[model samples]
Target: MLTAPIERMLFGLSDDHVIVEPHSGQLMHPEALVAFQRLSADARDAGFDPQVVSGFRNFDRQRTIWNRKARGERPLLDSSGEPLDTGALSDREIVYAILRWSALPGGSRHHWGTDFDVVDRAAMSDNYQPQLTPQEVCDEGIFGPFHCWLDKRIAAGESYGLFRPYAEDRGGIAPERWHLSYAPAARELQDFLTAARLRDLVHKSDLALGETVCEDMDAIFERFVRVPERCYPQENT
Candidate 1:
């Protein structure tokens, strides 16, 4: 429930442009970088050197990904188009897809440089199915080493002031088993990144579409982004 002090800035660069390069290992907050290094070392000790697959992105990058999914170029949804694909999606369809796999740039915890997405390097490929479930990946056992490492880190992270925002919240956003946040800054960034501000930025920027795009985006924000802030108290306390 901590409040981030800095104003949200747009950092949504394309997946290809992420500083992580071919591996998508982009910029991370110093603390998170340290934690990741520790996590990586631990994973290696456990017989796996998990690599970071994705990290900080800018709005432009997020938009690119969203657009690709909308065009059916990227498998943002499932085969039946159920949860992941969601059927003949328009740009509006891209909204949920973006939320499910990517964030709206500034809205993403990675943009603040405090979050990262870890994946097994050996299994990941250019032909990788973006919508594949973690369980599916784990079935290969390649992800096991990292999972075991995460179990230990999750227990010790709080002491280092790191926490998982998307942890144990399967009902809302898909649980990103690999996504971890540096809690001290992330708690505040969560509040600072609001649906209203994000919408305004998107509109003012090049990501803005036609009238339909605006309306659809408005709806998407209400449904997916405008949750109660950490400072909100039940019944106003």
Candidate 2:
């Protein structure tokens, strides 16, 4: 996706990726931002204050997350949301554990500026930080009812072109109900990011467990990176 040696607009590498929006001052595709604004407005009208906690993340940022978890600087959580003992695990094992929660640097859908990790403003106290766990987004969790509301909105096709790509757990990443994607803009980027292209980028990166990751590149792309085709209705049209 990098168009030039010095050019870094794609994947939040350059400053151009970040534009100021009234609610979220993060990086975003123009169309995605528009849809998000509408989505937020609609949520507000429905008595919820939806806020975007995370938006477009750059390659270096994603790499830092991967490397830190790999080197034991950060905690690697399992499918059940418990921390793993990275000290005793193989590099390959650590890689998989990290991929369970996070994406590879170049393989993240957030690179397209069309995805968001959102939470309900009314659901949290001033000091509460969203853990983004399944527990937090389940029926009894803080954002659970909010997401259930979203589920209905998306089902009814009133989500302002947004949908939850990670709403289903398919043995790769866990279900992330808080993750919202602007399908139209995201769909184009998703098609542009092929396993071969991502493998090439990962190989050239300074990511931790580089070789171990490349070994299962195809499966990684299919499992951790690519979401269900149903999320992209534009693809069928």
TM-score of 1: 0.67
Task: Give the best candidate by lDDT.
Answer: 2
List TM-score per model, in order. 0.67, 0.91
Least accurate stretch of 10 residues (summed lDDT) in model 1? 228-237
Lowest lDDT sum, 10 consecutive residues, model 2, at: 5-14
Q: Where does candidate 2 stray beyond 4 Å?
A: 1-12, 15-18, 233-237
Residues 210-229, candidate 2, lDDT per residue (tens digit)?
99898899998898988778
* Clashing residue pairs for model 2: none
Which one is best on TM-score? 2
lDDT of 2 at 154: 83
Tens digit of lDDT per residue, candidate 1, span 1-237? 212335433234333322332335366666666656766665666567566656665566666765565556666754223555446566655555556655554466666676666776655576865443566444355565556556665665422554455554433356666666666555555655555666566667555232344566666554454333442211210
What value of lDDT does candidate 2 attain over all alpha carbons?
0.80
